[model samples]
Target: MVLVTGGTGFLGSTLIKILVDQGTAVRAIKREHAVIPDALVSSSLVQWVDADITDYFALSAIFTDVTQVYHCAAKISYQPADHAAMLHVNIEGTKHMVNLCLEHAARLVHVSSIASLGVSKNGELITEDSKWDDGADNSKYAVSKYESEMEVWRAIMEGLDAVIVNPSVIMGVGSGSKGSGVIFNMVQKGLQIYPPGTVGIVDVEDVAQLMVMLMNKPEISGERYILNSENMSNKELLDRISKLLGKPSPTIEAKPFMLGIAWRAAKLVSLIKRERPSLTREAALAAASKLAYSNKKIVDATGYLFKPVDRTLEETSRLF
Candidate 1:
């Protein structure tokens, strides 16, 4: 049996449907209050269970007869106020998952993020071998993901058969104005300012397919793959989305100082509204960073060809 955490999430739901179509029986966990996506409501092969990843007892009860696990549950927040909660859910929750996977001797496919990967000093492409410095000025989200991955590595050292995937800005349909999907919405609204950064993007289907492929391969244990299809500046990416969505492309570039003001203003607004800031200092900085990731390792390892960025955008825009 296959067990999937975060089955209600964007990537997790996509992965579950793929497994169900392949005639695999899947046991997917969700938080008690989490709403099931419309796509999974009719999937007969999936057994939905109410469970919290941070609670070991809740997870332990559901691990019976589970032979394969996909650890997709994670907390992704860029605001400073959410740091503690993010740490608890991302780090401690992963600790619990790792322990349970170890106890059950199940093969694991951990869905990490490119945020956990380190940036190159000389602007070279970041691969799996790039060294991560905990002391460096990192975002709250990056630190949490890196620590979570540490738990996976610790489990690996103790003889757990596991593989990790670091996916960059996952783009696809059904995200509904959240995460990278927000970009599509912004483009539709005639967004004018573009972030001065370059990002790696991948189709959601590609990431899910690769995870299943890696899970089936016993020879690929203890390896990490960066699942990025292409690298392009935020401006170009936005332009492509705009073209496909039949919206006006962003023409103005948002400079660093402008972003500084924007985040500060958003913080002030958040304090007044008692809500999380839409724009954060760390997020603003990340929007200005220029980083490149390499998919050579995964490509060579599996001889897998990824979907083109244009094709992914086109399909997702059609859905939008």
Candidate 2:
């Protein structure tokens, strides 16, 4: 039997499908208030339970008969006004997963983020040994993820078996309208401009597969693996999307000062709009910051291959 948290999410649902294809009994945890995906509901091979992991008793009940665990649930938003809630989900929730895994003797596969390791100190493809000291500069999303990784290290000290996969910005088919909205909004709105910058890339399917491999590889415990396929400039990404959508691409690059003013103004509108601000100062910094990482370690360690960037873009574009 296998346990998958966030199984209806982009990566987790794909992982659940993979496990079901392999004839493994899969159980997943989700909120009772949330809508369950039809595929998971239709599959007789999967047991979808509505429960929150932060609740110890709920998690204890779901972990039963679970030989291996995939802890993929997470909460990353544009600007998390509720910092305490985000911490509970990302930090303390991880602590619960570690404890529950140990109690069930289940092999744990934790889904971490590249932000946890902070910026690449040398402006190069960051490897596992790269340090994260800019926890203060990054957003609450980044801080929460960084602290979550620390939780794993603490678990290792307590003799827990686990492996971590750090993925760059994920792009692919997603569940409902969540998780990938920033990218979706840009594509949906038909952007005529984008800020000048570069960012990392990874397909959702690739990340899902890597998690299964890490779960099966005993030697992967206590290691962090990066899963990035390319380092692409903002212009390049917009151009690709433009060409696919047959629309004019954003050519004029906005100056950093101009972007800052626009972002602040947009944030003010956000306060009145009653939803997340489109142009947050935090989002702008993450956008402007160079986001690239090394995936050679993941390739060499797990024998995983990535889909070509053009193909990944094409498939995901079909969604929009």
TM-score of each: 0.98, 0.94
Q: lDDT scores for all predictions?
A: 0.93, 0.81
Top candidate when judged by TM-score against the true structure: 1
lDDT of 2 at 63: 79
| Per-residue lDDT over 1-320 for candidate 2, one digit per residue giving the tens place of the 0 to 100 score | 88888877878888898888888788888777766666667888888899787888888887777779898898876565767788789888888998888888888899999988887765786778888886347788888899998988888888889988888888876633565535645766777677777888888889888888888878767787888988889889878877876677887786678679988998789889877776777778777776678889988886778977778777777776
Clash statistics: count for each candidate: 0, 0
Error of 1 at 2 (Å): 0.7
Model 1, 1-320: lDDT tens per residue?
99999999999999998999899999999989999998789888999999888889999999999999999999898889889999999999999988988999999999999999977778899999999987777998999999999999999999999999999999987677798888888888889999999999999999999999999999999999999999999999998999898888888999999999999999999999999989999999899989999999999999999999999898888867
Candidate 2 displacement at residue 157 in angstroms: 1.3
Collision pairs in model 1: none
For every candidate, C-alpha RMSD to the true structure in Å: 1.1, 1.8
**Model 2 stretches astray by more than 4 angstroms:** 134-136, 175-177, 181-185, 272-275
